[model samples]
Target: MAYSYYAYTPSHTAALVFAILFSITNAATVAQWIRYRAWVWLVMVVAGFMESLGYIVRTVSTKNPDKKGLFVAQFCLIVLAPVLMAAACYVIFGRIVYRVVPVESRTTKFLWVPPGFITTIFVTCDIVALLLQLGGAVLVSGTQPTQSNVQQRIQTGKNIALAGLAIQIACFGFFSIIALRFHFISKQFDKRLADKTTDETTEDEKYIMVNETQRKVLKNWRPLLRVINVACILILIRSIYRVCDFALGKSGYLEQHEWPAYVFDAAMMLPTLAIFVYWHPGKYLPYLGFRLPKSRRENL
Candidate 1:
């Protein structure tokens, strides 16, 4: 039997709609990057581009489902795009630490890793996962569906992809812990600041001097953090879905049904992009080339 690129015919309407949506989001992300020059949103721009292109190729796949090249291209783009988005999330969290947390607290470290290096650590893990998934996607896409050993090759590829996803999940888990820790610590710090007497000369008060505008910006960090946490949960749900989808093999119900992919992956990721555009971090964080207000005591 010839290899079936899709168990059910791909939906042209759905693919085209998603392609357009992602394109719009990508354009918006580019605009945000141009306006703010924040490097983190640039990562989101690339992910959005990949998503748009993937759906475009998927639209083509609806017409030419048996074309291995189209299948491979869409597979690679859609699978790898989220990894980049996840990296953006990591970078955003690091920026939040720098922008909101007091210099005194973060100067030492946050969760055993310096605030500056958070992006480096998580993104390095993301890169490793991306490469692994890419390799697995190629292996799976290249296999001849009718070969006697086809099932075995497919299983090998699935295992590799699963391994990459496992790493991503682990990273998210650890990152969440760090984020929650920071959240609680910041909350306590804020409370202490609120309770301080005007005449008190505590270390925190000395270090936390900021203009009214900067203080307002710092106050709004919680909303951005909540948005990020929501995005993280959606991505985690999608990741878990992918794991189950692959574990069931080619004959699995997920592979046979088209709706599940749209519901679990497409629907989930669309909002992830939309939320960022709506509550863009650039609006809250200082524009590129500007630093958050430095500690007044340090200047003296």
Candidate 2:
């Protein structure tokens, strides 16, 4: 006997709707990237593309629910796409640190990792998680329902996927702590700057003047950090939902009910993309060839 690819019949309407939604956001992000040329956002653009493609594949899967290939394609795309979004988040935070924090204060070093290395560290971890989840998804989707070892294979696959999800959760949790720490430190720095009334300015105070100048061209770093924090929380929530999903197995309540997947995964991820588009880093971060006024440059 063939395995049922889905616990419930996939809904074409729902899939199509999301496909269109993601596509729109993807296009908007692409335009934002082009307009601002913020290359760091490239990962986010890829995530949006994968999201649209995932939903598109899901829409197709509704027509042939028994096709394992279609099932695996949609599953892998949907599951791994968020990893890219997570990677983008890591990069965004790093960029924010570089742009907002004064290098003269040496607070950048206090981040436990340098701003430049933040993307390298977290995104590398995210890749490991992505690969693990991809391998597990393929393994689980490859199994035949009638095979004697089917349950064992499914169990093994779920274990691997769970391991990936666990890593994601840990990474997100640590990343959140780091972000919170940075937020507090930044607040303190801002407060100290405000309290000082000397004509003689500290290097950190000079950096704030430059930041204010940049703010005229780019979105304010403070609000951008808040946007990033919200996006991070959304991704964490989705990751937790995925952990429960794979742990519960195919017959699990979340698996059996399609609504939860939409509510927790699809609905949650849509805003993750949409929020970025609204407060696009490209609009906020200084891009290549962007120059500060000669007066501001001379001040530094």
Q: What is the lDDT of candidate 1?
A: 0.77
User: Over the stretch 1-300, how does candidate 2's per-residue lDDT look in tens digits?
Assistant: 544688787789999999999999899989988887777678888999999999999999988888888889998999999999999888888766655555555434688665546778898889989989998888887677888999999999999999998988898779987887787777755554344324444433222344344223253467678887888888989999999999999889998989988999999999999998888777666652233234422211
lDDT of 1 at 273: 88
lDDT of 1 by residue, 179-228 (tens): 76676776756554453323333432222334322132323457778888
| Every model's TM-score | 0.84, 0.86
Candidate 1: where are CA atoms >4 Å away?
Answer: 1-3, 107-114, 191-219, 288-300
Extract clashing residue pairs from model 2: none
Lowest-scoring 10 consecutive residues by lDDT in candidate 1?
291-300
TM match of model 1 to true structure: 0.84
What Cα-based lDDT does every candidate model obtain?
Answer: 0.77, 0.79
